[model samples]
Target: MNSQSPQTVLSGLRPTGRVHLGNYFGAVRNWVRLQEKYRCLYFVADWHALTSDYADPSKIRQATFDAVADWIAAGLDPKRSTIFLQSEVKEHAELHLLLSMITPIPWLERVPSFKDQQQELKDRDLNTFGFLGYPLLQTADVIIYRAHFVPVGEDQASHLELSREIVRRFNNFYGNVFPEPQPLFTETPKVPGLDGRKMSKSYGNTIPLTASADEIRALVMTMFTDPNRIRRQDPGNPDICNLFQFHKLFSDDATIARVDRECRTAQIGCVDDKKLLAEIMVENLRQIRARREEIDRDPSIVWDALREGNRIARQHASETLELVRKAMKIDFPELR
Candidate 1:
């Protein structure tokens, strides 16, 4: 890939299960907008999931399918973006092994997520080689496609920086082969869960993107509103209300204005506000729900998409591996 060409952005999500409102607002929504300007490669990171959930691998297959369906339904056009599965491309493992040789143990140890996850999953034994080497695998995932940009949130900035340092080290010894990938910081929205915590599947507070209108209504109806406003006539704070935060995103200018005015003046009760927000959310996500259902019906079609993506991904990866072999003096002309 030419350095002067349009920047290439690579991002992948682990398919634990269904994508939720946080997933949409925090990442996928930005991804949709990014595709318009940059070359995008989005993949299902099933291999990464194995690092933590190796105990039960059966669920991964279904999770990947669900994740991919959500991706397509969220407006990741197959015609523009290369949507693929990580494990399907064999070269990633190869590149990970090669990169592993050069990466220092200290670098892996310092990754914030490593310790954070270890504490989070204390019941599971995470003291394994795969856990430490996941960052190297991530490095390979990006450079294999020669991606120059990675769309990431603030929490992930360190990973991109580490990948860039690795690229620099490799280039110093083997010549300039891979361009250091830059982090494209995406400003994620504050989409809270029903309990006002960060929306996550583990928390069981997420409103899934695939949620039905009735399900959405039910979830919103149960959401926490302003606690200070004890009475219906008490002046409410929209800023403190999770339902009002959602309205800011899904509701129109007129509706938002109405909510802001009514809430401050104690005209609109929390019940009425929540019901209105639920209706807005259901209407907003209705198209994505319909599209996801349609795509999920045909299993073969999903596989076909994955196969095609694998074909496209392997072409670039193979070329990079061949170059790496040459640089490391592994390829002998006479032997070939």
Candidate 2:
């Protein structure tokens, strides 16, 4: 916390199942780029995951390994970025508890996503204390390290405002023990699933980064396109087709241009476009699979990286807690 830089970047992801294409384009891919220029801290948010999946936690350990493996596969160099497990660092929990005491109840209740998720995930009883307090935990995750930037997409930038507000309020009461984290807006693409929905594991529509070429091909074949193009001869509106969006991201300029023109002119049928995208997708993802296989061969690489990062993070976090405790007159020197 003492060496806090204006360039320090902090972000994290939940330990869900396999890392998917949606997860790649949405966060990890951008994180890969961030590590090159900033002192980045990217962690597996296992403690945060408890907010919802507390009832069934059997998959969390495997999920954490899979998340770390996929992050490495997607080019997060442990040598460059600090990669740690959230639960391994006790300071995060302590900071969250301290912040909660000062953060107003109305402030947490007013977070837009708080109510949105509750209404959406009605199947799960989210009335627990953790569900409402995760945002505060998120704020603790950022300002505890006095992070300067949190990489998020443009639309989601407003979400950081809540964390910023908490930081301002906390610094006001506790002295400038933290820095308000700002959103480093990144280019996040909208990755749709095979069924034309947002690509999500919840929808059973995610293409995991570790998916085989054959599996990708099969998924691509099922990809939804313009419903208006009901026939092979029907000239499709590439503008309205999600598969064309895939072409833009995965295919080269010439191929993307060709697909755009051919689909418009009815020269390329849906099947042919799917085949082309499948091959291009598989080719682009080949290196990632190879890297994942190599990393998984020595499972110690993933765990070792976390071990070293946890050590480093623990040192910084302990120092930050000391500053926090002193600012609030809570560091009991007698106990030490």
lDDT by residue for model 1 over 1-336, one digit each (tens)? 565767889999998778898998888999899999998899999999999899899999999988888888889887888889999899999989989888899998888778888887788989999988878888999998889789888877987877898999999989988989999999887889889998888778999998999999988998999989999989999889887889988999999999999999999999998888888888899899999888878766667778888888888789989999888878787976
- Superposed Cα deviation of residue 232, candidate 2 (Å): 0.7
- Report how far off residue 214 is in candidate 2 (Å): 0.6
Can you give the lDDT of residue 72 in candidate 1? 85
Candidate 2, residues 207-267: lDDT per residue as tens digits? 8888889999998998889999999999999888989988877889999889889999999
TM-score leader: 2
What count of clashes does model 2 give? Answer: 0
Summed backbone clashes in each candidate are 0, 0
TM-score for model 1? Answer: 0.95
RMSD of each: 1.6, 1.4
Model 2: ten consecutive residues of lowest lDDT: 1-10
Instruction: Name the lDDT of candidate 2.
Output: 0.90
